[model samples]
Target chain A: MKLLSNSKIWAVAVIMLSGLVYIGSCTRDNDLIVPVKLTQPFAPNRGTNIHLPGTMTVGDPTQWKMDKAHSSVLWSSNYIGTAGLLTGRFNQFGMHDVAAAEMLNYVATGQPLLDNSWAFNEANPAQTFFSGYVQINQSNTGEPGRDGGCNISGMGTTPIVAGTQNLTVTNLAKIKSTKVEFDASSNGYIVTFDLTWQGKLAAPLTKSIVGKLNYITMTTIATATPYKVFGLQLKFQFNCRDFGITSTSIADKIDIECNMNFNNK
Target chain B: MPDSFFAYAEWVELETFFAGYLLVYAIIYLVALNRPATGFVKTRLLPNLPLAYAFAGTLYLGLQLKNAYPDYTIEHLTAGVQLPYLRIWGLISILFWIPLLQKKPVFSLLHSLVFFFLLMKSLFLQLFTSSPGNDMARNNMKIYSISIFLNLGALILVTIISLLIARFNTQKRSTGI
Candidate 1:
């Protein structure tokens, strides 16, 4: 009887002890809080192209030039299509190295960008969407490298700002040899771009646009792209104005100016 | 009895069988604890707590094996594989009945051997056949560390309890009751 009783007591004691030990083991070991270190630094190698859309006026016929005093050419587009949209930008435009490097670092570490999402008003009833990019590369001379791409979606409401209306004929003729120029001044830089666009009316309309010339000017202080972790810093001001468009047409003149800051470290 | 009682009873029975297979280490520990450390063994405790250490080691091996071959038949048996080491106290309860039954040493030893062999087979199956995931392979350091700690602690506890039991048996024998 005594042996049985003693065995029960021992058994219960072991049970209680095991319970305590199991509970202790289940708790996380708080002392080991060492952070993981990166094995090696990743080199940022890719580049990207930045694009800015422009708007033109409707009527008063006259030549317009991209104002280089208050506008700087950061980047441009390439004409990929034949007719519907003759798109291309200045080839010399490219991103600084620091901004490219930093973007690569963020990608390597799997870090999320802070606030990359924005909403804007829709421009045309037929145009369902519009997106933009800020391409970065090693040199502004050779082929540009594409580093990253971001989408601008849900821009639901367009701003009620007015566009130029008195566009003349001289501005329409200068669109053929149009070139975008940037001038670095004491205060800041200015960008001036000229374009000549002409298209016939799709019938039922009398006045066909034989020549449509347009110019855009912008000005801003140079600012580097913001990267939370690492990269090259490229700074540039944001300002854009549109010229050239005649008569009442479906297309409207548009211009935008905003700062773009990025890093490549 | 209520329906819940039957359900719980069924679960307990299933648990017992699963625990029996999973925790063969507990059986080995119980048998080792019950064996007499007589003859040349002058000390009250076994010189090395081999059975307790083996129990902990096998328990850890079982857990690792489960991780490697996660899709094995036993995955559906219980949630989290029900750490076999946790069944140690249950075996300890059964050990309480052993003294009263006065089972032969040969029978107890055979029983222990069978349990040990089953534990070894389960471990081998897991190591050789299971497709261990990337996380298990990468985090081996943490897993091994926990295994070593568990085994060491279990060995110490089992040794102390075995020593106490052996000493108590010796005292009872000497009292001539």
Candidate 2:
């Protein structure tokens, strides 16, 4: 009881000390909790009619362009046990809104088209498209030290010079996808890209790592903006070997998510 | 991670969690040392210390929950902040746990603090932070947060119970009951 037998005097003193430590915090509305999904795989629903775009309906695929300022690409990966979650993003890449006639029609009609597919202009359903190339070196993992680590060791020269990190990674600089297509199995769009990882980096002991960056992201919205627009999300998974990363400390697999916003270009 | 790197470095985050847990107790024990070692010190104060730490741990965990996200940890806030001590904190805390062997009220207070510290600043921070990233996760986090607070409040009540028991013993011994 004597711990507080000095209660009155200690109360004043303890309060003073508490004040020095706590100093108090002000409640503000500044923090934004960005959402992300890990280990998410994409598989569109099936049994529905598949619409493969024709050159005429889709327009000049080679003529498409992405407005850099309007879109963003964020990626996330994991550590082995609990280095916590690791995330990085491309500061520069190519991505733009889907300008498909069906999607635009949906925006105009305020309704999605039938057969579980986007209701495009019936005459040219494949006329809608969204595509671009994602640069490698442009990936800023948020941390300079981490970015440096990835560039110097993890990614090797691909982000810098493709052949330097993994001689086999001939397309070292980017992961390019042509168009986003609706998949019946997963009820999502399937866009594919190839990542040339360091399958085998030059070494003293010969590390056996075969690397390749590959993914199919299911896009979503964080919040909605007018024109049926807002930020887009792409979530998927990959193996560490894809980047020629082979170590027990390095996890076997990692989940990735990308967030982007696009406007009509 | 590669064969050349120590895998332990990735998971055992001493800088944030382990060291943070140890510091919660060290701070309380050091504070108690400055005061007179009354009978209440062993019974009431010691247990109370850990409880206080619990409060600290929770707040810290809640605030630093952002670090669980790689984007947040690497987001250039403490540009030069690197604590080698965190790596060694686990080893140091082994010694720190020695003081906890004796103090009950102090232990409760200190133990709670460690719990809170680990949750907010250590591995638990990531679990708790990421738990709320989605609608389902957010719902689960609500239950989790409620339980954490409830447990903390329970510890506070236990400290009070210890205080009453210590007072009853003091009264009995004084009157030769």
Clashes of 2: 42
What TM-score would you give candidate 1 relative to the actual structure? Answer: 0.25
In the order shown, the candidates' DockQ scores are 0.04, 0.02
Query: What digit string (tens of lDDT, one per residue) describes model 1 on residues A1-265?
Result: 3432224343344334333433433432324346588664544322222212222122211212222222323333222212242222221111121122233222222112221221111121121111112221111323222211110011111111123211122111111111222222211212232222222212111121121111111223344632121111122211111222221211232222222322221
Name the runs in model 2 displaced over 4 angstroms: A1-65, A81-83, A95-132, A158-187, A190-232, A247-250, B1-177
Interface RMSD of each: 11.3, 10.5
Best TM-score goes to which candidate? 2
User: Could you list the CA RMSD of all candidates, in the order they appear?
Assistant: 21.6, 26.5
Candidate 1 interface CA RMSD, Å: 11.3
True interface contacts retained by model 2: 0.00
What is candidate 2's CAPRI-style docking category based on DockQ? incorrect
| lDDT for each residue of candidate 2 in B56-105, tens digit (9 for 90 to 100) | 33444444455554545545534433433332333332332244643444
